[model samples]
Target: DIVKANSREPISNEGDIYALIACCETGAERLSGMMEEFGIDHLDDLADYIIDTSYRGTIEAIAELPKGTWRNVLKVDGYEQEIDLHAALTIAEDRVALDFTGTSGLSNKGINVPLNYATAYSVFALRCIIGPDIPNNAGSLAPFHVTGPKNCILNAQPPAPVAMRHTLGQMTPDLVYGCLSQALPDRVPAEGASCMYDLPLRHTPEAVSRGDEQFALELVFSGGTGARPGLDGLSATAFPSGVWGSQVETTEAVAPVLITRRELRPDSGGPGRTRGGLGQVIEMRSSDNADFMLFLSVERVLNPANGRFGGQAAAPGRIRISRDGPDLPGKGEVRVKAGETLIFETPGGGGFGPPRERDPDDIRRDLDEGLISRQAAHDIYGLEP
Candidate 1:
């Protein structure tokens, strides 16, 4: 989301950050002049240096995420294996720095991110929590920088397993945002799912003798995110990593599966004036085949994202297979067969405003949209269904 213009000029803090970015990009001493105007000469000297490092490192990383994945390694076409990622930031002075030199080296997974993509996500995280009102651009990015080890998992070199790169890539935003939060409070949101719960499905049957036909490839859904200030946490919305939801038709047509039931988990959202977004409970099974391998990358099951302010923390996420019946323990990744169904209950977002202060109309609207159950509305928001 873009920041809206305020009625008056942006506060000096905002202007000084922008001026620093502009100077870094233009290589003009004029930015230094602007910094002097704000009593921030230290930032002027560091602006270009920060921008140069962040811009170059981010661009370079962008070029790499897709190229190193298993998809490219396997020689698959049409998937393009290409992604569009960009970076922009806002700095008030010499307060922030982006450093890629300390990041992990390249990996062999198909999910490895081009340095640029990593930069984009990192910037995005900062954007989401730092200065939602600031325009994201090269100038804003000027004061930050990132660095990684020559060949760490985050900084994959080549011939790495990149197919599941986003598994780790998506966390950069939160990681970087964590750093920013130390410098800018009130501006940052709480931590989120970080990992997309993205998984690759394949017919990697337990019995190799059965062959690959029993295996199928596909995608899955995610759980909830951490709560924000005055806003209840969001359930099931991928934050800091907004990969588009896979269309039902697209998913069915591409793989041998169908979504039997997918709906919000009642009372799943944490209580607050702005309650967390509710997570959903999804059930799925194989249509054409029963056997498949769930290659998963998920977090928050053991450690849920923490909430800021007085808001309580949201619940963790979980994935279960229902062959034996009832709540099953979710293995990070598992193999399954026909007749087996997978059930996933994502985490809930933290609450923002006080639950008692929630608008009655908003409660009614959530009930109308199936976001909050009638009971939840009454219990959490003190509104009758």
Candidate 2:
């Protein structure tokens, strides 16, 4: 029902149905195999023990946190406008609550987030901070509660065009983390390029008329993670999502597009004591001068990830046509004409501390590996070659 309503294509749901059946069939086999290997019919007693232990551990961790209220706001580039997401968090002795009271109203665009989806991301971020080693079962998750206004972006009503909820949904971690950063300044990492850059590409109708093959391909990738208190951020890594990106080989094999370049952009990571992760630069074009269409929505173009503890903000993202062509907006469907290449530069994560505090050895290493330019080292890091 959801697939048909949003995509207006009933055929797409076949893949989901197949996966659902596959999981159910394979899941039973895996469970039986596990029981046979352990010489037990079920792990019910063990599950209870683990959940109890995890619950106690979670309680202890929550007790350690400073009890107070913290508020933070984040703005995202919606389809045609920017929308704010506000969060007020309160950590009590036994529980934690995140309230999205002042967040923007529902966007007619596909970016609205359902209440349940918003709660999932908000609580996940909290769990990562408290009881990170815990198994994160129902017991560990029981202490956190999330709520928002019914019409807010984070809790939109029906018919609000939530087909693209992930664009904003993926950002919930950052919004909640922003509040936590104020509570535990040293524990949290700086903001990062949080959303996945997934491009749904297809041959345009004109291309099909001109003999181009009909194909639809999805290429997903992500930017860097924020720099941690004691460590530099990861480059071209998927932070919040933890897993993203479709293989270049797979896309090339299934589609008529040539990926010309995929490399880390130097100096894209914010300069600081613990440098943020780097973003990627990708260049691609339709094969044999055939026109194509690309659908994408990404963040950090208008407002890059902000730094924590005096760290610097990351470089903004960019998407444009190659060969001195015009820049394109970050959202919506874009047409790619013949003789033009799509150049996309994902934004990096924010730095963690003051740039001067960075290790000189790390600076030398960055220069040796082409992570940062010599000029950036001299100017931004205040170091000479």
Candidate 3:
């Protein structure tokens, strides 16, 4: 019924419509089954119980926070130069408010973020660390209030280009954590590669004329996660995005490109008491006599993830035609010649504590596994290989 009501608009793509309907139907069926098992005779009663319980839990959680204002500023690789994302978190007994008054103004490019999207991520970050076990519903989210001055990057009005909003939106978690770390130092994690690496591939006109089976493809990849208080960061894991990396076989079956090499880079993770996660390297080339265009939008290029508690920063990321060639910027579109290969090195996570405090046995394990070079082991971890 919901899908039918939403089908008022003209359907330009039947496949997309079918997929949406399937997703909606699956969710509805699950909710109905849960209600039945719980013996929920009245939908209104269940709704009230959920809302009231979540609201009370949210209030109790907010009351635990120290009443004060904490501020943090983050720098991102903008269209032409660096842009700052400023956030001021104010905690009270009843609610929490995030203010972006001092953030940079909206860019002329497509990297601006809308107010609703910004607010959503801001609340999500808070919920992650505060009352994380609580059920997320309308009531649980009602205590968060996000605001930014008009014309700023976090509050861009209509007519502004926001095509790549996620480029900066995903950074909000790190930005918010900056403030929360001051209040709950033990609970927050170090900075990490928060944004996703998305690549769009399209066949060249010549390949199209040759009757290629697949003409377009999109491949998604992730970087390392920041180290935690007592554990090492996850290697090549998706953080805020919660998305899995695409399989090489899956991509090859749909695209006219061959993945030559895909593996973790040695010593990519930052060295510390609790080591950061490791990043990966990917190399690909177009099929014989077939050229393609690639679209790139990634972050942590200019300012890599920052470490915490005297730990070292993670390795920065890069993209290029070859290992020795000039590097490509974080966002742009380029053409790949038939025989030319494109290489991508994702960013690593930030360490949690001082490098010298790391366990020697763990360091030896990394060395034996070829995860770190002997020189890095001696210099970064101060250990003889």
Candidate 4:
């Protein structure tokens, strides 16, 4: 029965099996070679030693947070109705556990996140907060356990329309960190634009059939990262994932789009002692006289990145057709007419500390660099006129 079920399993593409097998074989050869280079007789013993060392470090880091239970709940802008994501974290002397027993049920859309994906991000968040530089091997991961109900959004069952799993999966770090912020007050950074602002574009079938160039591609963009306890947030950065934003030159070389303008938005970052990172403004139109489609699924449009401690929330994102066109929804597909331009203003990160405590020099630097306007620097940062 098991063999039959495995054989009957659904696959997106037949090439996937070949790719997985190839990767597996390559990894095995590499691992064996590495073991030989280490002069290890048995792999089990070596694994044990590595795990033990990492475990010890994990225990030490876990000790920093006082033993206690911290809980956090936030709402997701689901397609139909609001979805809830609840985290109940329990930290003991030597270990930590996160439970998602109260997360919303599965969604009809493609945002459902499988357990493994959710677990991967959840563990990643804990590792980032607990020991960012520690080896993410089996030993290091042994100290943490994450759980969710079978049908919860974080643990979707099969056939749950999870093609866009990362849409929700990427938000785990922020969700998990919310609980940790309680235990380690000033340690964790504030909420950030967790998910990348991605634009998946493709030419219309008619355009492809004509003499126009045929192209289908994706361009990923980043927003500001949340400010840390003592440091200002980074501008135009992808937090948690740390993936690079797409370069304009690279996109122009392949995709059929003409970029009109791309720059950092002034005062987009929230104001605080250590200001949040600044988001960016991107404007583009179809290069050819052909209409194109853009499919977007991202956050930080309706709900801006929230600040930590006494900080302020960062700016929310916006998507729309040029000047007079109606504002586009955060999720869904939209068409860009041949001569029409599309504008996307990505969200900024939440600030750290109070706005009144910001340094005058930092505010001045932002103004000189055009990261923030002089008016905003004076108004928001309480700078002298």
Per-residue lDDT tens digits for candidate 4, residues 221-283, read: 889988998899999998777877888886786667889899998888888888889999999
Which portions of model 4 miss their true places by more than 4 Å? 1-42, 208-211
C-alpha RMSD for every candidate: 15.5, 4.1, 4.9, 6.3
Per-residue lDDT for 282 in model 4? 96
lDDT of 3 by residue, 1-385 (tens): 0011122433233676799999999999998999899988668987889999999999999998899999999888877779999999999999999999899998888889998988887789899988898899998999999999998999999999999998888888888988988888888888888888777777665654676543565677788888887888888888888878878886775566899999887877877888888888999998555778888878888888888786678888888986677899988888888788899889888888898899999889888988788998899899974
Per-residue error (Å), model 4, residue 322 = 0.2
TM-score of 2: 0.90
Every candidate's lDDT: 0.57, 0.85, 0.84, 0.84
Q: Lowest summed-lDDT stretch of 10 residues in model 4?
A: 1-10
The alpha-carbon deviation from the true structure for residue 13 of candidate 2, after best TM-score superposition, in angstroms, is 17
In model 3, which regions exceed 4 Å deviation?
A: 1-41, 205-214
Q: Residue 328 lDDT in model 2?
A: 74
Cα-lDDT of candidate 3:
0.84
lDDT for 281 in candidate 2 is 92
Summarize candidate 2's per-residue lDDT along 97-134 as a digit string, tens digits.
Answer: 99999999987788899999889878888888888999
Error of 3 at 200 (Å): 1.4
- lDDT of model 3 at residue 45? 80
What TM-score, computed on C-alpha atoms, does each candidate reach? 0.61, 0.90, 0.90, 0.88
